[model samples]
Target: MASIAEVKAQIEQAKQSSQQAMRAVQMLNNQLDQAIQQITAASQGTQHPKVQQSLVALQQAKQKASEVQASIAGGVRSATEYAAQL
Candidate 1:
């Protein structure tokens, strides 16, 4: 059985790891945005079906990434609250 302090430390570590993963997801989302922009620019006012689909896919991915980040943040907040109680 772990002491309160040890359990708190473990929770904190998990929180940090989750935060790091959130950051990485954010970075990937940024890159996806860049790709979308580049594709739009390359299209130069042409309505390409494939390009439109690609853009939509990227946008969806960004939205999902944002949700993931929010979820992770919530988890971290919960962990912090639990640690405070400890």
Candidate 2:
């Protein structure tokens, strides 16, 4: 088993990693929003099924990204709280 200081260090590292992931997820979501907007604008007059499929995929990706962001935020919070306890 690891010592108390080692455990604390591990928790702190994990918390930092989680925070980094959260930032990345935020950036990804922002980019996806821009892509969706562009896709919508480009497909304004087109009845192509491909466009529809693309939009659907983008929406799905946005949803998944949101979920990931939430998960990462929760992890970061949990890790920080745990490390504080130590």
Q: Give the candidate number with the greatest lDDT.
A: 1
Show the lowest summed lDDT stretch of 10 residues, model 1: 43-52
lDDT digits (tens) for residues 1-86 of candidate 2? 99889998888888788888888988988998999899889889888999899989988998998999888888878877887787
Q: What shift in Å separates residue 11 of candidate 2 from its native position after superposition?
A: 1.0
1-86 per-residue lDDT for model 1 (tens digits) = 99998998899899889989988998998899899999999997889899889989999999999999899999999999989998
Shift in Å, residue 40, candidate 2: 1.3
TM-score for all models, in order of appearance? 0.95, 0.83
In order, candidate lDDTs are 0.92, 0.87
Model 1, stretches more than 4 Å misplaced? none
The lDDT of model 1 is: 0.92
Best by TM-score, which number? 1
